[model samples]
Target: MDRKQHIAIFTTASLPWMTGTAVNPLFRAAYLAKNGERKITLVIPWLSLKDQKLVYPNNTTFGSPSEQESYIRQWLDQRIAFISGFTIRFYPGKFAVDKRSILPVGDISEIILDEEADIAVLEEPEHLTWFHHGKRWKTKFRLVIGIIHTNYLEYDYPRSIVCNVHGVNTKFLEIGKKRFEQQHGSNQAFTKGDYYIGKMIWSKGYGELLKLLHDHQKELVGLEVDLYGNGEDSDQVKEAASKLKLTVRVHPGRDHADPLFHDYKVFLNPSTTDVVCTTTAEALAMGKIVVCANHPSKRLLQAVPTTGTEKLSSKKFASVSLNLWKTIEDTSAYVHHLALGFEATRRVFGAIPGSLQPDEEQRKELGLTS
Candidate 1:
C-alpha cells in the first residue's frame, strides 16, 4: 500500500528453524520475488542446510550468533544488503520466543527507521519488547505486526500489537470461516496428503495425537504420520511414539524436504506458542487436514473458550478462539495482508498472500493433486 517500500526480514534462526515459524517468512519473500516488484531481503541468523535448493530463493543468506555472539558480530561488523530496501545486519539474540528479553530493539528500530519500512513483520515480541510499545514508530510506518505462527499466543499481551494465525490448534483440523469460503463452493475436503513433515516438539501434542492414531489404528489403516524437523525434544517424541506404538515413519532433518512424496492426511501442528503454523499452511496448500493442538500454549483450564482457553489474552486485542478453520483464516489473512503490501509494489500476488508459485509447485512435486 505504501510506496513500493523496502522490506527486510530478520530472523533469529533460519528456515525450518522449528517448523512453521521460521520457514514461512522465507517462503513469503521468495514468493514476492516472483512478482518482480518490491525488493525482498532476508537476514537470518542461520540458513537451514537442506537438500532442496529450488523451494527457497537462492538469494537468502545467513549471519547470526550461533556459538554465542560469534555470528552476531559477523552480521554487525559487515553491512549485509541483499535486496533494495530489504536489509538485515544482525541483532543480539538474548531471548527465546515467549521468554521476555529486549536485546537489540533500539538497533532494530534504527534499522526500521533508516529503511523507512512501511511495515515491520516481527517474529516474537519478546525479542523486541521496546519497539513493540513504541507509539512514535507509527510516524515512520506500520508498526510491528507480530506473526503468531504457533497458534497459541505466547506473549504477556503486548499493547498495540496485532498478530496472524497459521492454522488450527495442535490436535484438530477444521475449515476456518474465511478459509472455507472457497472450499464451500466445492464442498470437497481439502486435498489430503499421504504423509506430513514438521518439527516434533512438545507443544505439538505429538503424544496425544499419536494416542489418537494408536487408538484408532484401524481408522489409520492407510495413513502414516511422517515427521521431519529438529528440536531438543526429538528423542522424547520418538519415545512417545514407541510408547504409543504409532506406525509413523520419521525422517528428521533441519532444512531438508523429504525426497519421497506423501499424500498427507493430517499436518501435525504441535505449536502451543503462537496462533498459526507455517507448515500447517504449507500442508493445507498441499491439501492435508491439519490436526493442531488448539491452545496448546496456554495452561489447561476447565472452560475451553473459542481460541483455546479464557486465560490467555493479548494487550489490546482480545485473544480469539483457536479452532481448525480459525487458524487457517488467521494465517490466510496474514499472508493476504503481506500480499497486499507485496502486490502494491507490482508483483503479481498469489491466491494466498505472501506466497508464490513455489507453494503450488512444491506441493505438486510432492505428488499433491491440489
Candidate 2:
C-alpha cells in the first residue's frame, strides 16, 4: 500500500468570513482530502470576540473557537463528500486593523511539529506574519509552497505560485440551482437587468460605477442594476444611487452561490485592484456576460468568451454598457462548457506535486536541487 501524504495548510481566514481567501483554501483542502489518500490539516487563526469586533466591526456571525469549528465541519459536510481525513486546528491570533487581517500570535512551528506534515501550503503567505517571522524554522518541513491570492507584486517566495484565475465550487452552485428551480419553477428565465455582488467599498469601484451612471444618464436611461454587498459605504452608495437617472438598487451581500445570481443577464465588476476577482470568474462560470475593468491585473479575464474589460472612464463604461445590453444570449447553453473548465482546475490541487513546478531561480533561492 502507498503511504499517505500528510499536508498542512496555513490560512489567515476561514468560515463565517466569506472572502475569497477563506472560501478558496477551504475548498482546496476538501478537494485534496476527498479520496482518503492524504491527511489534510487546516490551521486557521482563532481571534477572540473583542479582536474580531475590532477587525470586522460590521460582522456579527463570529463565535467561540469551538463554535466556529462546528460551523466549518457542518459546512463541509453539506457540500463535500468523504471528508473523513480533514481536521481543523486553531491557533491564538490577534487582529491588525490597518492590514484588515489576523496574525497568528502563537508559535506556528508548534503545529508543524505536532502534525508532522510532509508538505506545508501557505495560502497568501505574505499576509501571514508567522511565515515571515519563522523563516529560520521553515526547513523543518520537507516542502513549503506559497500560493499568492492578492496583488502584492513585491512578494516573492522560493516556491511561490500566482494564479491569475481561480475555481468555484460548481457542485454547490448546481445544488443551489436545483433548489431554486424546485422552489421557483424551472421556467424562470434570466432577468433583464445587470447585477454586482462583492464588498461595497469605494475601492471596489463603487465611486467609478456611480460616476459613470450619473455622468451619462441620457445614454443609459433604461439600464438597471442591482448591487449586493455591505461595507462602510453602503448607505453612501444607496444615497448616491437614488440620485441617478438609471435604476440602481443597493441590497445586502448574499452567498456566492445564491441561485438568484443565475437570473441576471449580465454581471458588472468595475474593480481594478483585485488580482484574480473570484466573483467575476464565478459569474462567467454561470454563463453571465461580465463587464469588468481593463487593467494589467485583470488580463486573465479577457480570455473568457463572455467577458469584456473596458477602460474605467465614464465614456468607455457608458459605451460598453450600451453595446452589451443590445443582445442577451441564452445563458444556459454556455453553463456546462464554462463550469467544467473551472471544475477541472479544482482537481489540480489533488496532484500538487506534478502541478506546481518552481523555476531554477526559485529552486536556488530555496537551496533545493532540481
Candidate 3:
C-alpha cells in the first residue's frame, strides 16, 4: 500500500488567538484530516499570555504554554478523536504586539524538514520571514503552496494561491441553526437591527461606522447597531459609540457559531484590509445581508446576492446600508446557496490533489523549469 502523504501546515497563530489566521487554518486541518487519507501536522507558534503579560483581545487567559497546548489538544481530541493521523505541534515563539501575532522563531525550515512533509502549506507566508525568502524550501517539498491570508503586497512565492475567502464549516452553522430553532421555534424571527461581529480594532472601520451613524442621524433615526468583538481598542470604540445619537452597543466577542449571530436582520462590515473576512462569509451563510466596503479582495463576497459592496465613505456606506436594510427580503432561502458559493470557492482544501507532478503551465508557475 502507498504510504500516507505527510502534509505540514505552518500557521502564525492557534486556538487562543481567535483570529482568522488561526481559526481558518485549524478548521481546514481538521476537515482535511477527517478522512485519514494523509498525515497532517498543524504547526503553530506557542507563547503564554501570562508569561508575556500581554492582553489578548479575545479575553482568553492561559497560565502557561503547556496549559494552552493541553487545552488545544483536548479540544481537538474531543472533536477529532477518531482521526489518528492528525497532530498539533507547537514551536517556541514570541508575540508581536504591533502585529498582534505570535511569529515563529528559531529555524522553521529545519522544523519542516524534520517532519518530512511531502507538501508544506504556509498560511500567510508573508508573515513568516524564514519561509517567504524564496528558493529555501522549494527543493525540499514535493510542492510548496502559499495561502495568502492578508493584504500584504510584497510577498509572493512559487505555486501561490489567492483564496479570497476560506470555506465555512457547515456543521457548525447547522448546529447553531438547529439550536436556535429548538429554543425559539422554527418560525422564530430575527430582530430588526444592524449587527457587526469581528475584531473591535479601528481598522475594522469603527470610525467609518460611527461617522455614518452621526452624519445620517436624521435619516437613521430609529436604527440600532449592535457590535460584538474584543480588541485592544475596545474602550476607544465604546467611547466613540457613546457620543453617537443612534443606539449602538459594544459587547465582547462570541463564538462564530453562536446562535445570537443569527438574530440580526443585517450585517455591516466596512473594513477593506481583510483578504478573507471569515465573519462576512459566516454572516452571509446565516442568511444575513452584508454591507461591506468595496475592494479587490472582496470579489467573492461581491458576487453573493445577499452581499453589497460600497465605496469606503460615510455617505456611500450609509446609503448602501440603509438601502439594503429597506429593500431586505426573506434571506432564509439563500443560506444553502451562499454556503455552496463559499464551499465551492474553497474546494481545494476539501480534497487536496495528491499528484505532485506539475503540467507545463503549472511547472512554470512553480518555477520547476525555465
Candidate 4:
C-alpha cells in the first residue's frame, strides 16, 4: 500500500478579500485537494485589522476593543471547526512574515513546523523566508513549490524551488472558468458595445477607462460608460468620473453570468497591476473585443496576447470594433491555449518529485552560505 502524500499550501490572503493574487491560488489548491487522495493543509493568515473593521464595524457585537480579540478567536475557531470530505485542513495563523515587513500577529511558521509536510507549496513571496531563513522545515519537506501570480515575485525569490506563474477565466471572472463555460456556453456571442465590470479600485484602473471616455467625448456621442461592482474606492471612482464630466452608471453587484455581458458592445480592462484578469478572458471567451489601457508585466504578456486583445489608443477609441466572426475566432483560440496552460501547471504540482534543488545561478545570486 502507498503512503498518502502530505502537502501544505500557504497564503497570506484568505476568502472575502476578492483580490485575485490571493484568491486564485487558493481556489486552485482546493480543486486539486478535492480531486486527489492526498492529505492537504492550507495555512492562511488572519484577516487584517483594517479588513476586520470594514467587515464587522460599530453596528455588531464585535465593536468594542476588549471584545475584538475574543471575536477574532471565535471567527478563526469557527472557520476551522467545520469538517469536510476533501481531506484538506485549514490552519489559520496569527501573523505573516514577508520580505520587506512583518504583518502584525499573522505568523504561520509554527504551523509549518508542526505539519512536517512531505511537500510544501508557498503562494506568497514572504513564505520563502520561512523555509530559507528558518532552516527547520527546509529538509523536512521533500519539495517546496512556489507560485508567482504577478510581477511581485519576478524580481526576487528564494534560490530554492520553482515558482510557476504568468497565467484567466471568462463571462464572469469571479466564478470558475469551467463553470462559466459549462453554463454560459464557451462560444456564446456578445452584442454589447462598451462596458467595464469589476471592483472600483485604483489598481483595477477604472479611472483610465473614464479618461478614455472623456477624451473621446465627441466621437462617442450618446454613449455612456456603465460601471458595475463595489469596493472601498467606489466613492472616489464616482468623484473622478464626475470631474471628467463623463456619464457613468453604477449597478448593484451580481454574478458573472448576469445578462450584462450581452448588453455591452466592448469590454474594457484598464487594470494597472493585474497579472491576467479573469474579466479579460471572459470577454475573450464571449468573442467581445477587450480594450486594455496598460500592458501587463512582461512575464504575463502571453496571457494577454495582442492577437485577440487591443491596446487602448487615443486615436481610435470609438472606431475599434472588429468583425464579430473574426473576433470570436481569435478569442476562442486564446481561451483554449489558456486552459491548457493552467492544466499543465496543475499537473506540475500534482506530480512534483520528493527532493528539489535551486539552480547554480540562483544560489550564486543569493549568496547563500548554507
Candidate 5:
C-alpha cells in the first residue's frame, strides 16, 4: 500500500453542482479527507447566476447569485474542512463538463507550483492539455492524472494515468450504503412498479422512457413509475405523462437514500449519453431490478451485455425494445445481472491508481510521478 500523501484536485465546476459528473470529484476529495491520511486541496470554479440557474434551479433558492455561491462554498468548506490549500475561484474563461473549453492552465499551473503538490488530478483531457502537453508552462508535479467522468474520449489518450470516477468507491457510496440501507431494508413493500432518479433531460433518456410508457399504456396497468430530478425536460416529461395518462410520480429533487428504493420493483436507467451512471449502481446495490438503456462503456457493458432480445412478459411491465431498452424483468435474472454489473463496477473501484508511493516502480513504468 502507498503511504499517505498530499493530493490536489482541480475540477471544472463548483462544489454545489448536483450532477454526478460535477459532484464525483468532490466525492473523491471527501473520501481522501475521511478514509486516507493525506493533505487534500480542491480547486473548483465559481459559476455565475446564469450558469447556476441553468444547471440547478431548484436547489439554489437564495435571493441572488452571490448568496448562493457563498452558501455553497461555506457548505463545502464545512464538509471538506477548509484550510489554506482549499480554493474556490471563478475560472478566467468559460468552463463546462461536456463542452470543449480550455481552462486558464497558466493560472492553474501557478497554483500547483505554489502549493508544491505531489499529485495533480485533472478532470479530463481538456484539462490535462494545459499541464501535461504545455507549450508556455508545464506542471512539474510528481504525478498528473485525468479523471474521466463522462463519455468524451475522442482526443488521444494521455500518457499519464487516467481514471473514471464512477468506477471508484466514493464517499457518496460509502455514506449511502450505511444511511439509505439502514432506513430501507431488504423487505420489499411494493410488489410491482418502476422508478427513475436522475436529471429530467433528453440526454438522460427520460423523454424516451415516457414515450415507452405512452406506447405501452395498456401493458402497464398496475405498475407505477416515479421520476426524480429536475432539468430542461421537466415540463416535457410531465406533459408526456399527462398525455399518456400514466400514473407517474414526479419528485422535484434528488433522493438516493430514501425508502423509495426498497418500495420500488424496477429502477429505470434509460440514459443515452451517460458513461457510468452511479445512481443506477446505487439502486442495484440496494437490491432492486434495473432496466437501463444500452451504452458503450466497457466497464458497464461487461456486466450488462449488449445482446439478448428476450423481454419479460407482464401487464405490469413495459419496455421499448426498439428504442434500445435493456429490460431486466425476471426477479432471478435481475438479481444475477445486478450482481454481475455491480461486481464489475466494484472491480473498477479497486483499480484506481491514486497516490502511488515515492518508491513504486509502476508509476515510473507509466511515466507517472511518485
Candidate 6:
C-alpha cells in the first residue's frame, strides 16, 4: 500500500482572520486529502484577545479559539492530523505551531520536528525566517511551496513557488509582467489569478466615487456611475456624493451583481488598498468600462482611462477631456467585452478542488462573510 504522504499547511492567521492565502492553501490541501493522495494538516494560531474559531474547515466547528485547543488536543489524542472539514472523513495529518511566539518558521519547524512532515507549504513566506535553519528541514519535506500575491513581493522574494494573481485582468497582468520583467526579464513563471472581483464591501467608497462624480458632474452632466456595495462606507459615500452635488443610490447586494450593469454605462472602483479590485472585473464582466488606477485587472477592459509608471503613481485622473468623452461617447458596446476572458479563466482553475463551508453559499447570497 502506498503510504499516506504527510503535508503541513502553515498559515499566519487565526481561523477567523484568515485571508485568501490562508484559505486557498486549505482548499488545495483538502482536495489532496480527499483523494487520499496525501495526509494534510493545517497549522494556525490563536490571535484573538478573546478566543474564537480561527477557521473551522467547511463550517464545521474545528479551529476557532473557543474550539481550537480542545479540538487540536483531541486530534493529537487520536493520532489524526488531517480531516476533511467538508466530508468530515478522518485522515492522518498534524498541527502544532501557528502565528504566536513561534513565527511561521518556528511553527512549521516545530511541526516538522514533531511529526516529520513529507511536504510543507507556507501562506506568507514573508512571515517565515527559516533561511538559517534550512538544513534542519532540508530532508523533512520534499516540496516547500510559497505564495506571492503582491507586486512588492517582486522585490522581496528571492524566488517564488507560485504567483497567485488575484484577478484575471489584462491590465493587471500587464503591470505584473512589467514588474516581473523589470525584476527578472520576461521569463516563464508559475502564476495563477484569483478572480474574486466586485465584492460589495460594507465600506463602498461612495464618498470617493461621489466626490469624483460631484467634481466632474458639470462637465459630465446626468452621467450616473453605478456604485455597488454595502457597509459602514455607505453614509460616507452618500455624504461625499451630497457634497459633490451628484445623485447617489444604493442597491441590494448580489452574489454576482451582473444584472446591476444592464443600465449603467460606467463603473467606478475607488478602493485605496484592496489589490483584487473586483469592480474592475465586474465592469469587464459586464463590458461596462471601468475607471481603475494601476490595477492589474483594469487592462482586461476596453480602456484604462489612465496608467501609472511608478509605484503608487497617479498616471491619469478624470480630466475634462476624458469626462466629456465618457459622458457622450457610446458606452453600450463595452458591457460584455470582458465575458470571454472570465469564462476561459474560470474553467482552467475551477478544476482545482477546494471545499467551501456548507454555509458559504448562503453567506455569499446574503452578502455577509460571517
CA lDDT for candidate 5: 0.55
Model 4 is weakest, by summed lDDT over 10 consecutive residues, at 97-106
lDDT tens readout by residue for model 5, 1-370: 3655767787765534456645667666666666546777766544334445665556563344346447755655554433433333333223343433223322344445444567778765354342221221223577767666556543234233323345443333554455455558874335557888886777778778888887888988866787887777788777777776668888775546555455666788887555667777776666566897666532355533233356568534544542334333344334533432343442343311221121233223223333
What would the per-residue lDDT of candidate 6 be over residues 59-175, giving only the tens digit for each residue? Answer: 344423435545544433332235554211111111212312213211135544444467776655544432112333334567777654223422334333222334432433444
What order do candidates take by TM-score, descending? Answer: 3, 2, 5, 4, 1, 6
Q: Comparing 3 and 5 by lDDT, which wins?
A: 3
TM-score of each: 0.49, 0.70, 0.71, 0.57, 0.62, 0.44
Local distance difference test scores for all models: 0.44, 0.66, 0.66, 0.50, 0.55, 0.41
Estimate the overall C-alpha local distance difference test score of candidate 1.
0.44
**What are the per-residue Cα lDDT tens digits for candidate 1 across 1-370?**
5556556665544432344434455555554554567766654432222311212233333322243234333432332233323333443232222322112322334445555566666655434332222233334456545554333343445233233433332212222433355456865443544444555566556656666777887766766566664545677777766654446765665332222333334556555554444555545554456566646343222323344335545633444434645677657545644534442331342122222212343333323234
Give every collision pair in model 2. Answer: none
Residue 224 of model 3 has an lDDT of 91
Better of 1 and 5 by TM-score: 5
TM-score of 1: 0.49
Model 4 C-alpha lDDT versus the unseen true structure: 0.50
Relative to the true structure, candidate 1 has a C-alpha RMSD (angstroms) of 16.8
Residue 204 in model 1: lDDT: 55
- Clash pairs for candidate 5: 142-369
Which candidate leads in TM-score? 3
**Model 3, 77: alpha-carbon shift in Å?**
6.8
Q: Output the lDDT of residue 327, model 3.
A: 49
Which model is ahead, 1 or 4, in terms of TM-score?
4
Location of the lowest summed lDDT over 10 successive residues in candidate 5? 350-359
Ranking by lDDT: 2, 3, 5, 4, 1, 6
